[model samples]
Target: MKRKAPSNPVTQTQKQLSLEDDKVKALFNQKIWDPKFQDELKDEIANAKPYNWGTIHDLVDDDLLRAVRKEIETEIHFTKKETDIYKVNQSGDLANLSGLDWNDLSRLPNMYKLRQILYSEKYRDFFGYVTGAGKLSASKTDMSVNTYTKGCHLLTHDDVIGSRRISFILYLPDPDRKWKSHYGGGLRLFPSIKENIPYTDPCAKLVPQFNQIAFFKVQPGFSFHDVEEVRVDKHRLSIQGWYHIPQKGEDGYIPGEEEAWIDQNISTLAQLESRTLQDFEFPNAEREILPFHQTKHYERLLTGEEDNNKDCKFLSEALKLTEREIQYLSQYISPEHLTAEGITKLQKSFEDNSSLQIESFLNDPKSDLLKKLIKHDELNKECPMEAKDVKAPWKTATPSHKWRYLYMDGKSHEYFATEEDMLENLNNEEPSNFKWLKETLINAKTSNNDNELEIALVDLAQFLKSLIFKKYIATLTLLCPLAEKVIIRRFRPGKDFTLATKCNLSEVLKGVEGFVDAVLEATLCLTPSNGWTSGEVGGYELYMADETIDEEEKDDTQYERDVEDATVYRRDDAGDSVLINKPASWNSLNLVLRDESVMEFVKYISWGAESSRWDVRIQWDVKSMESDV
Candidate 1:
C-alpha cells in the first residue's frame, strides 16, 4: 500500500488547523452566518440612513480574544503618533505577519490564529455578501492596533486608500467593563455636503463593546467617519483593518481595478485645492475691493518708497475722510497709535518684518469695559459647547475636521442668510462709515446692557474697520481700502481647535504674481485663565512652513509614509517658520501677515484650562503694487 503514504503528514496538519478555525467560528454569535440573519443584515446595511454600514456583537470567542489582547499587551511595543487629524498609540503594521521572525511569531500565536480566522474563506464570503464589495484579496492583508487614551481622537475622513474594498474595526476595550457613550471613543459617521465634502456634524454614531465589530464598504467620496475623542481617562483599544480587492492569482482578480480605484478617490488635500469647491465651502474668502489707483498708493506706503507726508495726503484723499471722521475714531482709538510718529515707526517695523503686536489696541476706557464684560460672561454665563446650541450672533465653524470654534460674523442678525444676503441687507443709501461709527458709539455707552457681550464684540469690530484704523493699516502694511472680515471667536476648554492649514488665495487672486499672496490676520486674545505657560494647557497659536516635497517623492508611497502627515508636523521640525507664536493672554493683540506657503493652527485647548480662549479675529485681502513697479 505504498508504505501507507507515510500517514499523510500534510493531511494531519490541515486537519488540526481546521479544528482550530472551527473553534474560532464557534466564538461568534452563530446567527451572524445564518441565511435568514444575513438577509436581514443585508437589508439593514443597504437601507441604513446617512451611509451603508453594519455592526455585530460577540464577533469572536471571548477566551480567544482575551488571549489575543494579552498577547498584544505583553508582546508589542506601541509608539505615540500625533497629527492634526489624530492622536493615538499604535503598534507596527500587524498585517506584515509573514515578515516577522520566528521569535516574534512565537509570542503572537493567538493573534496569528485570530488574523487567519478573520480572513478565512468562510467569513470572507459572509462579509462580502453583506457588504456587496465582491471578493477580497487572499494575498493582501492591512491592519494595525491602536489605543486611544484621554484626549485622543481621529478626525473625519473616508478610509479610501489603494485597492481597499472594506474597512472594519474590532473593539477590545476592557472586556470586563461597559463602554459608555459619554466616555466618547464612539465611531461617528458624517453626512455629505456634496459629492466629496462631508458635513461638519455626524449623523450616526456607534458605541463599541468587547467582542464587537463594525464595518462598511470603503466607498470613496462618501463614507466619512471619525473616532470621537476618548474622554474620562480610559484606554480604548481596537484593531483596525482593511480588505482589498482580490489580488493577482486570487479568485475574481481584476487586472487594473485596484489602481483605478485609488486614482478615483480624491484626497482631502486635493479637494481643498479645488477652486470651485473651496469657493463654495469656505465661509470667508478674502475679497478684492481696493481700486487700482488706491492699491498703488497703499503699496507705496508699505515699501517706504514714497514721501511720508505725501503718502498721508494720499491716504486722506483716497479714503475721502473728513476731519470729523478722524475725531470720531479718536474717541475709541489709542491716542499713541493716532500720531504721525507712531504711525511711521509702525510702518518701518512692519515693512522690515510682516507682523506686529499691539499691546493696548483699544483705548484704555474701551479696553477696561470689554475685559470686565468678557470676564463676567466667562465666570457666570453658560457657554454653549455644541454647534447646535450656538445662538444667533454666533455660528459654529463647519466641516470641523479642519477647525472648531464659535464665531460672531458681525452680520449674524442674518444668521440663516448667505453672502449675497449681506449685499441686500446693507443700506447702500447710507455711507458705510456713518453706519459703523454710529453703532460703535451706541455700544460704547451701553456697556452695562444685557447684550453687553454682543455689543462689545461689534464695537471692537467697528474700531478695527474704522477709517482712522484703516489709514493706520494702509500706512503700516500698505494693505488699505482692503476687504476686511471681523470674527469674534470663543474656543472653550477641551472642546475647540483649528488644524494646521495653508491660506488659500481667492480665485481671482490666484496666479497674480507681485500681488501679496499673504493674508493680514489679527487676533485679540482674551483668555480669563493664567498658566497657559508653555502650551501645557494648549490654547497657543503656531505658524510653520509648508512641508516641501520633491517632485520625484510625490509618486513614491514609501517616501510619503516617511514624511510627517500633511495634516500635522512636529513642533520642533526644521523649517522656515515666520515665528509669531503667542499664548492666550488677557488684553493682548497679535498681528501677522501670513502667506499661502505658511501653515497655521490654534492648538487644542486642554481640559485643565481654567477658562476658554476668547478673541476677536480680523482678516484682510491686501493688494500688491509689485507688478506696477
Candidate 2:
C-alpha cells in the first residue's frame, strides 16, 4: 500500500491530457510571453491611436482549433435571433466546458482542453499584462461560439456589460481559405460624436482570419463596434468572450470596485438612452409647451386681429384655397376640423408647440375607400423581400439595418437599391422633391409603364399624391410656404421598419434658411383594421426630446467626454419616454414640429401584425414666423 501512494488527481489529469493531445502543446505562441515581445506589445497597445486594440495571428494550435470547430459544427445547435440591432445565429452559452460528465468530456475533449488553457493562471497573467486590465478572474469565464452566415450582422454597440474587463474574439473560419473583406462580416469600430453617440460609419475595420484573435479593453462608451452584414454565402465562426475583474478571495481582488464599475457602466446606458431619445426622436417634451408669449401671438392670428395690423395671413394663405380647391379638399378632409372653432383649437395647439394629431382626419367616405384599397392591396399584392424586385413609383429602402420599406417617393420610376442610383434619380428629376408626385401620377395615368407589376398599390400611391390629399395636409400643418416631400410608405410585417434618426438640414435646402428651428413632419396612418390598438405587433410611432449638447460644451476641455461623465441632465427617469404611440389606425393624422435633434421612427412591424402599417408620410422645411415676428 505504501509503494502505490495516493495518486495526485491534478497531476494525473495533466499527465493524461499531455499523453492524449500533443496539439495542446502549441496552443499559444511562447514568444508572446518573452520579455522583449511583452514590452513591445504593451508599448504598441498603450500608444495606439483612436483606441487600444491588438491582433495576433496563429494564436491557437491549428489541429486543436480545427477539432474544436468540427465538434462545434457537428454537435452544437444554433438558434437564429433577430432584432433591430442584430441578426445572428448563436449557440447556448458554453456552460458544458465548466462541468462535463465523462461521456461529454470524451466527445468534447479538445474544447475542454482549450477552455482549460484559456482560463489557466499562466494565460491569465499574460493577458492581464498585455491589456493592462489588471487581475482577471479564472472563476468567471464567459464565452459563446457563434456562426454568422449570409445576411448576419450586428449593429454598433459598446460591450460594457457588467463586470466585463476585456472583450476578445477568436476566429475559426475555413483554415485553408482566405476570408476577404468583400465577403463582409468584418468587425467595424466607430468613432464617437461626443461620447456614447457613435458616428454612423466605422472609422476602423478588422477583417478576421482563421486562427486569429482580436481583443480590446472594454471601455464603456468608447468601445463601439459592430459586425458588418455577411454579403456572400459563407460561414464566419468565432468564439467571443470576456475576462472580468477578479472576484472576492481571488488574487488581486479589490473590495467594492467591481460594484462601483458596474453601477457606473449601467448608469452610462441610462444616461445615453435618454439623451439619444431627445436628440434623435420626436415630440420633444422640453420644448413641447407653447410659451405664453407664443400663445398670445397665435391668439392674435386666430382672432383675425394680427392679420389686419401686420398683414400676417395665417391659415388662409397657407391653405390658398379657392372655391374649386375647397370642393376638392372637402372630399378628403372631415368637416370637424374645417370649422372656425376647430381651426382655432388646432392653431392654438400648433402655434404653442408645433404638433397636432387630428382624429377622423379624412371624411368618412374617403377614409372607407382608402382603407378598403390598402387592405385589398395588402391581401392581394405580392410583397417583395428583395430591394431590387420592388416596383416604382415605389422603391425599396436599402441598407435594411437603418430602414426597410416599399416607399412611393414619386421620384424614381424604378427600384434603386444603391445610394448612387437614388442620387442619380433625384438629379435627373426636374425638382428634387416629393412634389414630383403630381407629375408622376399624371404620367402613370396616361401612359402604361410596361414594367410596372402591382397596379393596385400604384393606384393607392396616386391617391396619396392627389391634390385633394395635399390640400388636407396643408390645412392641418399650415406648412404650405415651404415645398413638401410626400411619401406613401408600406411597412410589411416582419421585414420593415425605420431606425431612430433625426431630421437633418438637407444640403439641397440649405439656401432656404431663416425658418424655424423645428422641421414640420406629418403621418396619416391607415392600417384598415383594429388589431394594432395594443402596439403588440409594433408599428407604433415614437417621439422624444432632443439630446444635442451646446456647441460650447463640446469644446470645453474640462468636460469629461466618456461614459462615466454625467455632464448632461441626469435623472432617475432617464429612459422614460414621451411618445405619440398611436398604433396603426384608420384616418388618424399625426403632425409633429421636430427639431434637428429630435429623434423619430416607426417601430419595426412584427410578423404577428394583422397587416402592414400603411402611412402617407409628409415633410416640410418651414420657416416659422414666430422666430422673427
Candidate 3:
C-alpha cells in the first residue's frame, strides 16, 4: 500500500489555531459563564434607563487584552478622518480575518485569539442571553478600531441598518488609569420623545474603562446615542463591533427574517425624507412663495420695466441699487459691496464659480455694535440649555436626529404634539410682515439693555428680508428670487448642529416658468470670538455633492446597506465630493446656489469653542434671469 500522504503542515497549524472551548473560556472573565452573574446582567439590561443596555468591567483577560493592544499599536495603521458627524482616527475593519492565512494570523496572534473568542459560540450565546437580542451570526464579523483624540466626536444617530442585531464597544484605553467622565468620550444615550423622535439632550451616559464592554440591543427608533467629543489631548481607543442577525444554517436562522426586519425599520435617512414627518420638524424645509405682487416687482425690475428702459444690456445695470437706495442700505450693508463696480465684480465671480464669500459684508458701525453685543452676551449671560427653557422669538430646532439649533424665524413659538396641531398651525399661518420687526429694530438701536444681541440679530434678519436687499442679491447673483426665508440662527457650543441634508424643493415649483430647480443660499457669519480658524473645535459649515446613486440603479447589496446606514457612507473623507468647508468667522458672507444634488451641514460645536456660532441664514427660491434680461 502506498504510504499515507503526509499531513499538510499548514493544515495542521490551522487546526491548532482553531480555538478550543476551554481555551476560549479562559480568555474572558470567569463571571461571564456563571449562571447567577448572567441573570444579574440580564436584569440590569432590562432595567436600564433611556434604553436597554448593559456593561461589564474587566470582561476580557487582562494579559490577553494588553497583548492585543500591543499588537494593534505596532501593526495597525490609522487615518485621521473628519466628516460632518465625526472626527476620529480609524483602522481598517478587523473582520478581514477570513482573508488572512496562518502567517498573517501568527503576526497578530493575540488579536486573532480575541476576535475568535469574542465571536465564538460560548460568548455570543452569553451576549445574546443578556441583551435579549436573540441569536447572532458568527459568520458575520463586523468590527473596527477607533482612536478619538482631542476634538473627535460622533454625533447623534440610531444604529439601525441592515441585519444588525446589537451594537457594542470594547474599551482599550490605558489599563493602569481610569477614564474620567470629564475626559468627554462617553457614550451618551437619548430618550425618545416618541417612537421616531429622540429628545434633544442625552439622559444617560457611559464612561468606559479599559477591558470594559458596553452593549445594547439595536432598537431602531428608540436607541439614539452619540459619542461626546474628546476635550483633552488623550487617545481614547475602543473597538466598535456589531452582532448581526443569523444567517442560513445558524441555529436561529429564519428565511426572510432579515428582510422582514429591514422592511419594518426605516433608516434615519429614510425617516428624514418621509413626507409624513415634515410637519413634525421645526424650521421645516419649506419656503413661502414670494407674494405675486413682490414677484412681479422683481420681474419688472429684471426686465427693465421698472425703469421703462428695455434697452438695458447687463443684468448688473438693470438691478443696480440707486444712489438713494445705496445710502439707505449703507446703514446695514458695507458701502463697498453696494458700489456699481462692486456689483459687477460680484456678478462676474458668482457667474464663474456659482459661489462667493464676501468679507466685511456688514457696515463697520453695525458689525462692531453687533459683535460687542454678541461677545458680551457670550461672556456674561447664561444660555438656556433645555428646549423647554428656550425663550420666545428664539425656538430650538427640533426632531433631534435631523438638526438642533436656536433660530429666530419672527414667529410665535409653537410646539406641535400631534399631526392635527401641525395642520392647524399651517392653516392659520399668516403672510409675512416686517412692521413689528422694523419697530423692534428702532427700539433696539437706541436701547441700552441686555437684549441688544437678540435685537441686533432680529434687525439683521429684517434687513435681509427687505426688497431692497433682495435687489442687491439679484444683482450679485443674476438670479431673480421668487420666494425666501431669513433665519437668525445660533449654534450653541457643545449642543447645536444641523446634519447633512439636501434642499427639499416644493413640488409646485417643479415646472414653473424660469425655475432653476435650485436654492440661492447665503450665510452671513457673525461668530464673535477667536481661535476657530483651524476648525478643530467644530462649527464649520460643509457642503458636499450628494453622491448617492439612484435607488433603482443600485445592484450591490453591501453598498445599499451602507447607504441605509448613513454614517458609513459619510465616514470616509472623499476629498473630491466636498464643495465647501467654511469655518466659523466674523463679518463674512457665504453665498452658494445649491441644487437638489448638493448636501450641507454645520458641524457640531465643541465645548472647547470660545463662543457660539451666530449667523443669518437665508434661502431664496430663485428663477433664471436670462429670459427676463
Candidate 4:
C-alpha cells in the first residue's frame, strides 16, 4: 500500500515567525563563524552519533533560497514516495518534467537561473571550501529544491549517491525570529557507533531558525543526518545541492582525476557494494536477442504468418532447424528445455510452478538495460544515482532484474556486504575475497526452483559486505533498495572497531585501556600500499596523579585534574595525550574503513565536518542521590 506523508515541510511566513522570537535574540546575532559556535559545531560534529542529525543554520544564501522556494511553489511539480512529497528541478531533466523544449534558457528563466547559480564557479568554490574538498567541478552540481509535507520527512539516509563529492542543505525559514525547539521541525545530526546504525539523541539541532545552512561532507556512515518531523502545520523551504568533480578543464581536473581520487579513497568492501543496476524489461517489440540471452536465434528470418510455437522465441528458432534436430535443439536452447540450469534463472521465475511467463525482452538481450550497462562498463562512466536517472535508465530492464528492481523502488533497500567481512577476508586472502563462494552460490541460484537460491544470495551479500570493516570485530551492511553504493554499516562486537581515520588518533588511547603499560596496536590501516602514508603510532598510560611539574610550560588552561584514575596517552600521530575517563568509548567507534574498492565505501567512511565534535555521551544519568523505588 502507498504510504501517506506524516506532515508538510513547507514553511510559511507566519508559522516561520513562530519558530523564533526576540527571546532567542542572542541566537539571532550568534556569529555563524564565531569561535564558541565553532566549538559547539566541533562538539556536535565529533559527538555526532549515528542516527543523530544536523541541518544548516546558514548553509546557503538567503536570496537564492527564497527564489528557489518561489519556483517550487509556482512552477515545479511534485510527486509522492508512499506518503512523502517532493519537488525536483534538475537542469538536465527539466525538459522531461516540464515537457518543454530545452533549446533556450530564456524559456525557463527561473530554472535556468537556478541551474546557473548552483553550477556557478562561486558556489562551487564556496561548497568545496566549506567541505574541505579543495577544488570542485561546476558541472558536477545537480542542484534541486525539495518540499516536504506531513509525513514527508525522509527516513534515515545518507546522500552519498554516485559521483557526488559532497551534499548540503540550505534552510529558508522566517526573516524574523528563530525556528524554535518545541515545534519540532528541527534538523538533527547523528553520531556513528558504526555505520548505518544510529544512536538516539541529536549531536546538534537547528531549531528551525530562518536563513540558516547546515552542511557536512557526504560521509555515508558519519553524515547520517535527517529532517525533524513538522509537528504542526508548516512547510520547510530548503535547497538541496551537491559539488562534483571539476568538469573537464573547469578546475584543471584531468580526465581521470575523479577516478584517481576515488581509487585513492575507496575500500575493498566497497568493491563488492551493490549499486543502482538496471532491471529487465520484456522485449516483445524487438526481433533480435539479448547478450545474456542464451536462447538461440533462427537460422534464416522466419517471415511466414502461421508458424507453430510462435509463443516461444526459442521454439521459433528451432522450427527453422528442420525436424531431425528439433528435439535436440529444444533440449538446451529452448525456454521450455532450459532445464533449471539455463542462463536465465527460470526457477526464481516459476516459484509456484503455476504461471510461467518469461519477459519478452530476454528475447532481445541486446535490449536497453544490457546495452546501457555495457556502455557504462566500457566508458567506465560513473552514472549519477540521482533520482533523475529514473527518467531514462530504467526503461529497457527485463523481468528478472526488474523483479529485484521493483523491490528496490518500493523499499529503497537491498542486503549487501560489510567491511568487517572484508577485514576477515583480507586476513584470509589466499582465495581472494569470497570469489569462489559467490560463484558457487550464483550457480546454485540458476536452479531458481530450489529455495536455497535465496539463502545463497543472502550469503553472497554478507560475504561481499564483510570487506568494508578492517578493524571491527564484526560489521553489517544494508543497501538502499535500488541504491547499491550507499551501504549503511552496523558493527557487531568483536567483528569491527573504527579508529577515526579522519582524525589523528595516535595521540589518544594510550592509558585508556590497551596502552596503560606498553604501546597499543591499533587496527587502523596506514600502509603506503593502502594510500595512507602515516604508519601506526600509539601509546598510553593509566590515569595517575601528576608528580613532576614542567615549570617551563606551566599553563593554567590545562585540563583540570578532577579525577586521578583517568587514562592518558600520547599518540604517535593522532594528536596530543589527553586524559580519557571513558575507555570503553574507544572500545567501539563508528566510521567506514577506507580501501581501493568501490569508492562508495571510501566515501561512506570519509570525514566531513566544519570541525571535530568529540564527546563521551552518557545516555542515562546515574541518580546517586536516590535508590530504586
Candidate 5:
C-alpha cells in the first residue's frame, strides 16, 4: 500500500519558498543582514521567555515520503534504546550502523528538494527575514526521520541535541480519524531557565492534528520535556529535524558540533555543581552527577504537580496571582516548601520583597510554617561551603585532565572546573589564538622555583560558588551585616569548633582599628560586601622571611619560635599565611597563559601555604540561607 499524501496545510497567509526560486538569496540577505530589522528581532528574542512545543502534520507529502524512503531505505539504521526508540533515516556526515563512510544526501533529488525548501531564499525571506538572525556554521545541514511504534517512546529531553536553534516535527500519520491526543503520539513543550538551559519540568503540550505545524526554539534544561506514551495501537510517522547553519559546499565538519553547542548554553560547572576535574581528577569522578530527566514534564510530575495547566490561564478574581508568584513561576521552587503554609509564605514573601500582591482570600494561619521558616533563616546561615565541593559539580575534575593547570605557573592557586576545560580544546582547527597557551603555561612555572606565581583559574566558577554561599548567608544574615565580628572561639586541633552565633553588628565593624590589621594578618584580600569577603579564591598568602614559600618551617618549634615564624609578611618575599601547601604542591600546578588551549586537559593546583602555623581565632564562617519571607 502507498503512503497517504500530506494535505496542503500551507495557508495563504503563510509565505512559501521553493528551492528553485531565486528569491532565496534575497530573503537570506534581507532577513539576516538587515541591520534595523535584525536589531528589533534581537530585542524581541532577548525579552522572550524560554520556549518549545510543536508538531507538523504535512511536513512530507505521501509521494514525497514514499519516494524518499524508497531512495534512502538502504541507508537508514534504526537504533532503539529503552528511554527512546527511533529509526534513523539520515544523519549528517557521521557514520551509520554499517560502520562505513556514507555520502551526505547531496546526490538525492527529494533530499535536495527538502534542503532547498528549508533554506530556500523565499523561506529565508519569510522566516529568517522575520527572525532577523541565523546561525552561520561550518556544517549546518542535519536532518533525521524516525518511526515510533507500540510501547516505543521518547521520554523527556530538551531537543538540545546539537547546535539546534529550532526543532520541528513533520508528522505523516494515516490521514484518517484525528491524530487524537489519546492515540498517544503528541508533541510536548517546555519552558527554559532563560531560553538556553532546560528546566526540570514542562510548561506546555500539544497533540498532533492532521496537516498542522508546531515549532519552538530549543531551550536546554529549562525546556525539559518528553513525548507522552502512545496509548493506542497505531504507528506515528513524523519527520523530526532542525534548522542548522549552512554547510554550503565545504569539506570539514566536526561531529561534536551539536554537543558543543549544547555545552555552550549550559551554566558554569559551579552552577551545575558538577565535577572538579575528570575520572582521575579530584572529588571522585565516580560520584554521580545530576539526574538527566532530558524532558521536564515527567520529572515535574514526579514532584507532585502534574502540570502548569499547560495553557490554563489563572482566574484573576477567583484567586489572584501576585507578581512574586509570577516571578517564582520562572524559578525552580524547592520542593521542601510544598505545604499550604509554604505556599502562603511564598506568596507573602513576594508581597514583602517584591511588588507582588496576594489576594486576601488566600491568606490563612497555614502560612505560619513559612513565616517560621523565614524567621529561622533570619537567625542562621543555611548553606555552607563543604570541603567536598572541591570535587563537586562544576569543580569536580574529570579524568586525567590538566590542560588548564599547565597553562600557568603562578603563585597561590585556586582551581575551578572551567579552568580544566582548556585541556579538551586541542582539536581546534583553522586559525586559533589560544593554541600556544597550553605549552606556554607549562613552561612558565617550575613548581620548585620561588618566583611570584600566577594562578590560572576559572574565575567565573569560583565567583559563582562564592556568590551562592554568600547569598545564602546574606539571606540568613537578615539579622545584620557585620564587617568583622570576630568570635574568638578556639579549635583545639581535633576538639573544639567555631559556629555562627548571635553577635552585635555595630560592635563588630564599628571603628575597630585592629580588625583590618588582623584580617590582613590572616588573609590577603576580601570580597568587600558589608565588610564580608566576596571573590577571594586565591586567598591571601603571607610569604616567608625569604619572600618565598621555601622559607624554613620550624613546625615543632617552641611556642616562642612558632609565634615569631607565623608572622604575616607585606613585603617582597612573603611566606605561607593560613593554610599549608600539600607536598605534590602548587609546584606542578598547570595553567594557560592564553585562552587557546583545551581546559580539561590540565591538572589544577591549589595554593596551600603553611607557616610556623599556630591556630588563631575563627573569622570567616559563612553560608547561604533561604526564608519564606
Candidate 6:
C-alpha cells in the first residue's frame, strides 16, 4: 500500500489549526459569546459618542494571549518606521502568514493560531454583531503588530479605505501591570465639526490594557482618530487589524457592494483634490495678491525702470540694500545677512539648491530679546491648551485633518468655530492690519508685561509683511513677489502638526505674465530649546517630492495597503525624494522655492519635547526673474 504514506505531520498540524466554532470560542474569554453580554455590548456601541465604538476587557484567554505575545516577542522582528503621519516599530503584515510554509508557521505557532482565531468565522460574527458592522470577510486577514516606544505616535486620520468594514486594536502591553492613562499611547477619538472635518482636539480617549480589544465601524467622513505619542520609555504593544467587507464567496457578499462603498469613501488623495473639502481647510493655501502699489516697487526695481540701467548694473543695484533700508532692517536682521556680499552669496546658494538656511538671521538685540521673551513664556505662562482658550491675535489652525497649530495671520479676525464663521468672514472684508504691531511696539517701549511675547511675535510678523522685508527676500531668492501671506506659528509639544501638502498657487496668479508656478516659502525658526537636532523629539520640517503612481502599475489594493503601511509609500528611504529636513532651531531662517511638485510638513511635536516649536512661516506668490526683467 506504498508504505501507508507516513502520516503527514504538516498536514495534521494544518488541520489541527483550522479554527472550528468551539475551538475559537475557547480561545477568547467565555463571556464574549454570552447572549446577554453580546446584547449589552451592542447597546453600548449604539450609544457611544463621537461615532459608534466598543471595547471589551479580557477579550482573549489569558494563557493564550500570553503565549501569543511570547511568540511575537521571540519570532517576529520589528522595524522602526517614521513617516509624515506616524512613527512606530512595526512588523510585516500578519496576513502573509497564510502563505508561509508549515515550517515557518511552526516558529510562530501561537501567533498563527491567534490570527486564525481572530479571523475565524465565529469570532468575526461576534465582532460584527457587537459593532453592527455586518458581514466581515474572514478571507481578508489584515493585521500587523506595532510597538509604540518613546515618542512614537500617529496623527489624526479617519480609517476609511477600500473594503475596510471595521477597525480594531488588541492591546498586549505588560499583562502583569495596569496600563495607566498617564503612560500615553492612548487611542484618541476626535469628534467631527461637520462631515470630513474633525475638531482641533480629541474628546474621547481609551487607555488600553493587556487582553483588551477596542473596535469601531469604519465610517467615512467621520471616525477621525489618532494614537497619542508614547510619552514614556515603554513598549506599548498592540495588534492592529481591519475586517473587510464580505468577499466573493462569503455569506453576506453582495455584488458591487464593496465597489460602491469604496466609491462613497474616496481615497485621501482624491479627497484632497475635491474642491468642496478644500473650503474647510484652515490657513488655506490661498495667497492674497499684494496691492498693485506695493508690488510696483519691486517690478520697477527688477526691470531697471527706477534707474534705467543696463542688465548687469540693474541686477547689481537691485541686489544692493540702500542705506535707509539697511538702517531700518539692522534693528531686526543680522548685520551679516544684510551685507551686499552676504546677500549675493544667499542668492547664489538659492539658485543652486532652490533652498537656503541662514543661521542667526536676526540681529543680536532682536534675537536676544525674542528668545528671552519666548523662553520665559514657555516656562512661566500657561500656553493655551484648548481652542477656546486661544486668545486674540492667535488662532488655532483648524479642521485637524490637514493641520493643527496656533497661528497669528497678522489679522484681527475672531476665533472661527464653524463653516458658517468662515463664510461670514469671507463675506465681510477684513484687510490685513498692523494695529497690533503698533500697540505692541508702544507697549515694548513702555512696560514689560505678560503679553510681551505675543506682542513681540506680532511685531515681527508685521515687519516680515513689510515691503522693505519683501525687497530683502526678493534679493535673496531672486524672485519678485506678486502676493504674500505671513503667519507666526507655534507647534505645541504633543498637540500640533501640519500634514504633508503641496503648494496651491492662487487662481489669479496661475497664468499671469511673469508668474512662476511656485511659492517662495520661508521659515524663521524661533524654537528656543536645544535637544531637537536629531529629530527624535519630532519637530522637524521636511520637504519631499510628491510621488505619483503610474496608472499601468497601480494596484487595486494600493489604497488599503497605503493606510496599513504608510512607510512603504514615503519614498524617503531612497534619500533622493527628500529635498530638505530642518530640525527646529533658534533664529534660523530657511527659504525654499517650492513648486507644485514639492510636499512639505512640520512633523508632530512629541510630548517629550523640551518646548514648543515656534516659527514665522511666510509664503509669496512669485514671478520668474527673466519674466520680470
lDDT (Cα, tens digit) per residue for candidate 2, span 349-397: 8777678888998888877777676676677777776554665566665
Candidate 2 similarity to native, TM-score: 0.53
TM-score of each: 0.80, 0.53, 0.90, 0.34, 0.32, 0.92
What's the TM for model 4?
0.34
Name the 10 consecutive residues with the lowest summed lDDT in model 5.
487-496
Q: Which ten residues in a row have the lowest lDDT in candidate 6?
A: 1-10
Using alpha carbons, what is the TM-score of model 3? 0.90
lDDT of 4 by residue, 321-428 (tens): 344443333321233323324423432333332112232211132123323433333245332222223221121111111110101111111111222232233223
Candidate 2 CA-lDDT value: 0.63
Worst 10 residues of 3 by lDDT: 1-10
The order by descending TM-score is: 6, 3, 1, 2, 4, 5
Q: 393, model 6: CA deviation in Å?
A: 2.2
| Candidate number that wins on lDDT, 3 or 4 | 3
- Segments in model 2 whose C-alpha atoms lie over 4 Å from true places: 1-25, 93-103, 267-272, 276-629
Quote the lDDT for 607 in model 5: 16
Q: Indicate the residue-level lDDT of 22 in model 4.
A: 27
lDDT per residue for candidate 3 within 447-524, as digits (tens), equals: 344576777787788788888888888878878877788888999988888878788776776565667788999999
Cα shift from native, residue 31, model 3 (Å): 1.7
Error of 3 at 580 (Å): 1.9
- Go through the candidates in order and give each one's C-alpha lDDT: 0.68, 0.63, 0.79, 0.32, 0.31, 0.79
- Per-structure clash totals for the candidates: 0, 14, 0, 117, 98, 0
How far off is model 5, as Cα RMSD?
A: 29.3
Runs off by more than 4 Å, candidate 1: 1-29, 92-99, 291-353, 357-364, 412-449, 474-481, 493-495, 506-514, 534-538, 548-551, 554-581, 606-608, 623-629
Q: Worst lDDT window (10 residues) for model 2?
A: 564-573
Better model by TM-score: candidate 2 vs candidate 4: 2
- Stretches off by above 4 angstroms in model 4 are 1-64, 83-111, 173-185, 195-202, 252-257, 260-629
Task: Write candidate 5's Cα lDDT for 1-629 as tens digits.
Answer: 32232222333322332344553343223334456755665566445444423333344344655555554444545443220011112233321111111144433555445445554444544343334335433224334555555543443345444355665565655655577766766665545324323332345567765435455565544444455556556766555555544343433235665456655754222122333212223222121111225324212321223323331232111123335543332232232333446556644553353212112211223223323332343234222122232221112212111111111111112333332342333232122112233334346657552122111222211221232222222222221112211111101111111111111122233352211111111111111112111211111121111222232442211211111110111121113421121111111111101111111110011111111111111122211111211
Better of 1 and 4 by TM-score: 1
